[model samples]
Target: MELLPVRPTIKTPAQAFTGDVYMTPIHSGTGPSRMTVALVRFTPGARTNWHAHAVGQTLHVTEGVGLVGTRDGAVLRIHAGETVVCPPDEQHWHGAAADTFMSHLAMLEAKPDGGDPTTWLEPVADELYEKANQQ
Candidate 1:
């Protein structure tokens, strides 16, 4: 196997995210592999919009606390060294906790053809966020 070069970290677009978020490409699989990996860092109170993966998505928390919320109002708090797998087509959003900076390794398989592997929807509103985070 060949050694892969590090890719530049890109600030996540506001359309797909709220607040500050960045992503560093890890491995973009070649050919039919279609596997994509990135290290995503989220600032305090930052989060992604509602989204879904074409195949599926796996998130491994590396630092700080993270919040993974589904469309059903269930939000799970995941800590460092924890992992979460978001099933394909499951609309959900994830990001740093309200008071913490978080980072996670996001892994997913892209469509064999082309285009984005994830379908991004609307931003998670404050009311939803607050309600979802409630115990």
Candidate 2:
């Protein structure tokens, strides 16, 4: 097997996130492989917009605390070394809790035919964010 080339880290865009965030692509499979992996970091209170993966996604927390909220109003608190699996097309948002910086590895799968792997929706509202933080 060949070593993957090094790539620059990418700052998350304001349009896609609510607070300070960044990501480093670990492996975006080429050729026949359909997997993508990234190391994502979020500052306290930072979070992604609602989104979903075409195939599915798995997140493994590596440091600090994380919050994963689902459309059905389920908010899961994930600590370091914990893992969470989000089913395919299941809308959700994930980020750092209000009091800590957090980092996680997100593993996602692309569609077999090479279409868009993720569908990003609207940002999480302030009310929802507050509600989550209060939990």
Q: What's the lDDT for candidate 2?
A: 0.93
For model 1, residues 1-135, the per-residue Cα lDDT tens digits are 799889999999999999999999999988868889999999988999999999989999999998999988789998999999999999999999888899999999988777788999999998877765564
* Per-residue alpha-carbon lDDT of candidate 2 for residues 21-67, written as tens digits (9 for 90 to 100): 99999998887888899999999999999999989899999999989
User: How many clashes in each candidate?
Assistant: 0, 0
Q: Cα miss at 18, model 2 (Å)? A: 0.7
By summed lDDT, the worst window of 10 consecutive residues in model 1 runs over 126-135
Candidate 2: worst-modelled 10 consecutive residues by lDDT? 1-10
